[model samples]
Target: MNNWELLEIRESLLRDLAEFIEDNYYGTPAPHEYRRHELDVRLGKKLKFSSSYPQMTIRQRRASDLLLQVGLCGATEYALGTIEDEDQLKHGRERLVKMKGDLADLMRDYDNCLSEEERKLLLRQAKNNSNREESLKDSERDSLLKLVIGMAVGAYCYNPAALKNDAVSDITKDLEELGISISDDTVRKYLIQAAAKFPQARKA
Candidate 1:
């Protein structure tokens, strides 16, 4: 396949992974956060990379980043499941097995689309990125959890009083459905924090 076709396959895989995580793990990043736009002038430059022997285009870099995120989310789900719930743990393990196979196939196809030298360069870069991600896994996992909590808070911001009453259970239930195993007390804590930051939400 050509480079664009490979990119499309990567994009499709990323989307599938995101959907699976949102359905069975926790949540995925907001769609708008990943979309490229003409107004996003900085994104183009941020995604471009150059070297003396090999280079990565903006689209290729984006695919690589998406692949990394997909891997991170899958790993995080497995880690969370080990501590959170037995069902989740089982699901995490199954998903990871499938994901490994899918990723391996994608990498093979991606390598086929590149020259030998480019393949080596990309492999080296991917390894370095993976190593860096491993070092930051804890912080990244925390951030992901926080993002989910923040989303939960924002979802109920319009009805702050509900967060204190039966609404708190509703919020927790909703989060649980999204694969986020948050407690009512933790939900309340986040509500309070959100209220403190945006006092108007309390009035709402």
Candidate 2:
């Protein structure tokens, strides 16, 4: 019920609503629901975890997609993917400059009114916007995307032509031996998604 706790709760509820909206509105129905169900099941497991963070992240008592002008910049950062190299970075900076300026302008209305804690939060946020943090975000995003895509790749190897069932199992075994934390089910889901994207299968 403290301000910090309240803020975290609000953010979590907003995220869940956003997830629902994206699945219901933007994503394909059957597949999207499948993903949503998967998320829910994973979340159900998380409920038994003895952590406040998990509770704060999902299954809230109320929905709260009522954020103001400051939208999902973090999620946007997630979805926009990432730009590699200084040249791409510089171009992105140029494009974001105008938007950042606009944000600063909006913040001015509450400038003198901001709490000390809020001000420090803003300062850290500014530091985080520097390339180092952006790179960190990109690295994190890449890890998750790779998991999604890699799972698909592992799934494809499940039924490779000329390979016996035991041999195919060994192929997935090799992938695990290589140190990737993926499940056979995740791999199967990824393969289906990959197939949906390509017009025709290409020899690898």
Candidate 3:
């Protein structure tokens, strides 16, 4: 099966298993560690954190947990999907959309922060201050960057593979779906550069 399909199958099984544990094992005169271990084994993803963002802390296992809490509280109509009650999918979609909006907002800020004159000045400064800015700009890829900026953004936002594979997949996937058209590899390379800058900034 494809990765997404495999994910869905695994998710369905894990969901059923978790529910079984919660209902039958929790406070049911039975040990719970085995159930927890089974669930953990089912969820084989190991968490790798990034010091750069230092912002996103996923408290729940998945969006479903948050959706379940909302259901318990009668928070919104969203918790009721077509399947009687399980708005987790809806919540996941909303969460994805919200993340996309956030990335767009950030990109807008980046654009607003840098005026044409400032860009020229910065490019000039970079050329003067850096060791190989000119040579780097002379590359074929450098020329393509001017043509590919929007494509890059679209691709970055759409391809979750580029970001989620790292610590910042949420933004990356949302961005990919948001119509950014750059390649996933480009996004990863840039994100890595940004992460590299983070450690250097702290040192400075």
Candidate 4:
């Protein structure tokens, strides 16, 4: 398949996995957090097999390939969406759990499979990826908070108690339009924090 076709396949797989996770494992206050942790451990193993040993059977190779794409898509989503740092850290830790197992299996199966330097390199790479993901998630949350507070401030300037009564309907609507899901409680928390931090900004 061409590059475009490959990309299409990958994107399709990621979308299906995301839908399955959300639909089956969605919670009221928090959706997909638990489900994603489970899936990451399960599918990350499949993805790693496909990535590390593409020469395995064709079916195994294909499955792993698709899973790796899904994992990358998930990491990218964490970067763009407002998933909390704790949630991201949880996911990262789950990934490390699988990685530890996979590394052990690799060493057992093949002596000198990865040299000492190479082993260190691989561990560093994995640790760096986890750190980067957590950082990106944090950045996404902070940016969303700033945006919510900025919008709330503008609204409060126009009409005091704009967010107090409705509590960020406009923010939620805007996020929905952007295909970003965030809890109302999170928005309200940011609103309160902003108001408290900048009490002077509030009009009499």
TM-score of each: 0.29, 0.25, 0.19, 0.29
- Report lDDT (CA) for all predictions: 0.47, 0.40, 0.36, 0.48
**Per-residue lDDT of 1-204 in model 2, one digit per residue for the tens?**
122333343344345445333344323222222233344333433333435444443233223212222233222222222454667667666655655455445435434444578667755545554434347565665565555445444554433232122322344455656664443334444444544444244336
Rank candidates by lDDT, best first.
4, 1, 2, 3
* Residue pairs with backbone overlap in model 2: 151-187
Q: How do the residues 38-122 of candidate 1 rate in per-residue lDDT, one tens digit apiece?
A: 1122222333333421355433655454465344433444254235467766777777777666656656654555567765654
Error at 156, model 1, angstroms: 26
RMSD of each: 15.6, 15.4, 20.8, 13.0
Candidate order by decreasing TM-score? 1, 4, 2, 3
Best by lDDT: 4
Worst 10 residues of 4 by lDDT: 1-10
TM-score winner between 2 and 4, please give it. 4
Report the CA-based lDDT of candidate 4 relative to the real structure: 0.48
- Pairing residues by index, what is the TM-score of model 4? 0.29
Q: Please identify model 2 stretches exceeding 4 Å from their true place.
A: 1-68, 72-96, 121-149, 152-203
lDDT of 3 by residue, 86-185 (tens): 4665675566566445434433443354458854654554445344423564455444543333343344332322313332334445555665443333
Worst 10 residues of 2 by lDDT: 61-70
